[model samples]
Target: MIVFNEDGCIKCGACQGTCPTSTITVTPTYIQHCDMCGQDPKCAEVCPEGALKVEMFTVDENALDQPRLTFNSSLCTSCGKCEEVCPQETCVVVGKPNMEVEGFCVMCKKCVEICPVQVIGIPGIVEPKDCAIDLEGKGATYIVNCVGCGTCVEPCPVDAITLDKVGGTISIDENVCIKCGVCSQTCPWNAVFISEKYPVKREKDIIDFAFDSTSCIGCNTCVEACPGNFIKTIGSNLTIEVPDICAACGLCVKVCPTDSLDLVVKWGEAHPADAEGLGYDAEKCEFIGACANKCPTEAIRVVTKTGMACPSLVQTDEDPSFVNCIRCGACAAVCPEGALTVGSIEKMIDGKLVMRDRIEFNPSKCTKCGDCETACPYNMIHLTDDEKLPVKGFCTLCGQCIEACPEHALYDK
Candidate 1:
């Protein structure tokens, strides 16, 4: 995690006081890990250098005492509070290698309080120290503060550490360590250390949207309906072109009457109107252009570019037949531009339109399942699809038709 430089600590104990778990201790040299807590290590939060880090320990399925620590170098500040507070004087300092013995560690916790950096924590108790072996033969040592009390030994299921005095200094076998960090969490003194490697950065290309023209009808429905006003019509054929800023919302394809528009999955493909020399004109857009405004497909995105306040193409004029609409999709079904989609609360959210309680439907998908007709207590839902169309019906202000369409293909506005 993080560490402070040796002799860099001001011995203010600010970190220890700020610690929520009371895990830090002040001593003659610096702060260290306490081995009593089993899994909770709270010392890493206040460390100025972020030297205090966590490690993992892995034990064999048959043996559970093995544990190891994993370090994150990106977080380390190269502070040596670890060395100053270390009970063992031989511990390596951030930049120095002084081998002077500091003093016998009685688990006094004096060093923990003096550390300016909050990089220390108690190692967890799992394996007995006797079971540990120094693989590097680097003069691996343990503090006498480690009582034969065996409080820190058995928690390790892998038997990585042992407590027998005759078994030599406590050691960590690299092969046995699973990098589980359990031992580091249980230790009373902040003694164990771990290191991490940094990752390399790479470059990436930008992303954009594409559309197909064979299915397009040259109808400006998409251009007039787009909420973002990003999509524009350039040719009499109504060839639509998306700029680099196009978010690929697919609304253009949804509004195309002939289903001539399809989303382009690959990049760098020729534009839909490349042969016609026609491209969408972002500047010529008069009203918040189509694809985004009235798209039933929700393939176009207006909210991403212009945000929620963008005006919708739907007019507020109260339809004289508003009371007669049976929620039938006949009007949308006859639409040549695919602009008349049934309004719905869900569709509004998907289109990034202002949220409303109304529900709507797409004529393309509506099977006219008249569940709403049977449930209508009022004689409002027209049984005949063509007769119930919004343009040709005697709707009784009763909202039976609105509730009749299971597809939720009805709107009051």
Candidate 2:
């Protein structure tokens, strides 16, 4: 059913969006067929589809016990040898932006010996971590600076911030707080702040948490600080979440003062193993650069050159020498479109235009290999397989591209 059905899947990513594990990587070519490896394959192990006879393969124990592809950044020549030999499309796509190794790796040691500089090694693991936190404690500490000036009231896009006279403090409606950071930026007192990271509920006992209203001085700090508007005040009393409406964003919990919110999860809930975090299948990913904004870990940052080089993202007939592409060959390998090219030239950085050693690219033949996106040194790429940046002079900063982006995958602010 879900086993890469060509006729069924329109490839809009509705199922992948709902997939808790982030297992299904949406690639440019295909949804990444789950070659069922064997009777009890990992693909079939989690398939919500039918019991079809997929594919399989066997490898020698010694082959798997081989050294890994270690990157010796200092010695790399930016040559395309290793990437050309890489069995996995995403294994070693060296673009201007950084690239992360995905799960499709069959452990083939081709990269080990193929690397001209011997950068590949089998450390047995990349920087593996079950979780990461970006919380910036908006707690009671910042509330002291509120001063009840109400300067943040107008900028409060959601009206989550409100100052109460009886309470002699500012109060925030947590439910309505959107965490847009507008009020924080506009606040003259610099009192309001909110947590950038929120904890994902893992254990069964924790349904949610709350804030201490009595402890709340009603400064409306949380209201201005809350990106979600989760907390609010009713007359003199503070309240959050009306029983049925909680998205579990976790913003209100981390930003609240006095620990007013106490998580009361639904009794006896079953948490799926796939819910642990996110898994990205490189081969399945299409390099749309959409996932860059959603990932809290900054893990899925695929830079794109489409918008800058050519607004349509399609290839053009521009001469490689004119554009100053680095021609690192990283863009060539992952290019599903094969539209990129390489030649020596000069370009701009920051604001000053300077002459430098780089390559040229042809926008016409690119099929979206999406590999070169992460293989370059000056990777000015974005999400959606859109890596590498265009010549600075060509960039307009119109933001029209970002606004038009369906995934909102943007490299520049």
Candidate 3:
């Protein structure tokens, strides 16, 4: 059974939610208690406020030791409901008893509100009564109907109810089982049950990643963001190698501003690939194929029909940082031929080497709209079809394919 400090209660009702039994009741001012159901209290184990306490008896005589609930007067708020519903006459100071009393309390403390200063304390049973285990199967021993009021921490036998913090989940120590069944009987949620049917089991899942030679960009972003110290970049291309310690939290995917890093699960599932779709343009795209080079998973690759290198339509020494690339598929959207393809790296990886079917560019579709280039954060896209397009040239070399190409054959020289 759990006890409460009426004055200390904020009336949040968190204890009622955790109790395995429906033994706890809250009044406008204070909480009421039931003694018979509280022989072994589970309510005290779930309070997060530390407003409750557990009472234990000492064997030594002449010790002046009495197991009583103590409430801090400094904390009490003068809630009187604790006295209104107490089972014992001494437990409550309400006007009159609405129900008849069966017997005198044996100082069992079943009605004690450990919230010392404000609420009353009625003594009842101290030792738990031994009862036969009628249920053969392992089922919930405690079925508490929780009111979500967290007042039961006071009388817990094991000092289990810790209400000072968030309510933690319940745990049972099988090794300490005297099978007293106190916890099961006192729980309000009916969340606790005992079973002799099957053995207990536990399991956990782990994942790891490894970047191929051409996959990583050596950005070190994955290494810095990985919580498990699993990834390390080797060179400027962001080339990476994942160690055995990787837990695969996918933080690398979130931190990669270039959208280069990716996570591959054991079942062939890829991270960032499953992310939401973004818009892109296919026409007017210069096949410079920067997106493929920047991809960390090697999921994107450029395929050329001829062995000759495609001439660079534009070049600049200024490094364009991906930090400014707003991912507006402008370069791909204005292409004339069906040569440019733009999408998430994962979708690009799923395509065939030729990608002819996936590539889309229609000059007829062009409305001379400059919306695509205006959306470029790096200012890499030019509004005109001219090959020697003037640019701000802040390219980080994190190639996002140019969308202004009309030849359908432009490449990095």
Candidate 4:
């Protein structure tokens, strides 16, 4: 028989699962009682304490010597006086009708007579319950805090999950959910659930993005912005491939200058990081569009007050001296808020102009042999860089393709 010693119990709640007959139950404090399993006790075997022994019956007088807690289920009103009287901290003897007992119940019997209704058995064994397994991933909740990071969506093996934005509703299709528990496990916010009870359908974390081929310009900024490296093109094919890691972070959508990228933030319900080295203080933001220029991932963006999606919104620091804040005022020149000021930084950038299909280029340096054709993702340039991921006329002057150009043949001029 499995005997529960209240003193040795840590109240970890590890014992309350997967029992066949529902013989055992648990409260937050301790195992309520043992069903004995016809003399075979699972809780005793599972207990961290070797507290249970093979006694033919629980009536042996020695059972009282080890110190135990008992509760008369008929009389207990669950008013917490036993929990307050214990010298040990509250983890033991903590629950009222569901009491917790720490190491050993000193056996003082103070609890025996203290019950106003006389419900708590002097040293009571403890609570009961619905033993259920959720066949559907019904435990998921449409949280008020979905970030659309795509972390949860990527790990789901069955692809049964869907999600929307923060403050949006979400639902796991109970009919389709395989109940693998992947969404609840991967959620950083603890927002997704795989409960026995399905949370109501609210806005889901359904964010989607699309690539526009007509105005694509083959810039590959989206490629660079993608953390998963999910964007790729085999040859000069006009068709672009976006992979499953698409979480609609707006990293790529904000950087597309020709309005070639669109991010649909919320649509329907769906299944779904720690963003490192990232901080945004909105009051100081001036919508410069320079940070978007400087951002490696374009994670930070300026959203206009009119609610129109502006790819331009525009990081931080103590002079921990990690960032290149020369105080050059280059940002000041570009700040629409005029929040920043500069003294004397010089260099009139010779900007490139659009010619016909692409940027104006020096014909003497270009053979027009299509060597750079693959380098231009949009096929606008017949000859281009080899090291870079192929650019769209070097619009942002990110210097990736130009720096990697081996022959100095591709120039922004």
Which scores better on lDDT, 3 or 4?
4
The residue-by-residue lDDT of candidate 3 on 44-82, one tens digit each, is 232233222346554235343344232333333334433
> Candidate 1 regions off by >4 Å?
1-152, 166-168, 173-175, 194-413
Off by over 4 Å in 2: 1-206, 238-243, 262-373, 376-413
lDDT per residue as tens, model 4, 310-376:
2322233212111111121122222233222222212223553332111222333343344333322
- Per-model lDDT: 0.35, 0.36, 0.34, 0.35
Clashes of 4: 44
Q: Evaluate model 2: give its TM-score.
A: 0.20
lDDT of 1 by residue, 159-269 (tens): 656655421234555434332334433332323321110111111112434556766667777776443355667796768865443223344555567765445432222
Each model's TM-score, in the order given?
Answer: 0.16, 0.20, 0.17, 0.20
Worst 10 residues of 1 by lDDT: 195-204
Clashes found in each candidate (C-alpha, N, C closer than 3 A): 106, 111, 82, 44
In model 3, where do residues sit more than 4 Å from their true spots?
A: 1-359, 378-380, 386-413
lDDT of 2: 0.36
Sort by lDDT, best first: what order?
Answer: 2, 4, 1, 3
- In the order shown, the candidates' Cα RMSDs to the true structure are 33.4, 24.6, 28.4, 25.5
lDDT of 2 at 377: 27
Q: Residue 348 deviation, candidate 2, in Å?
A: 49
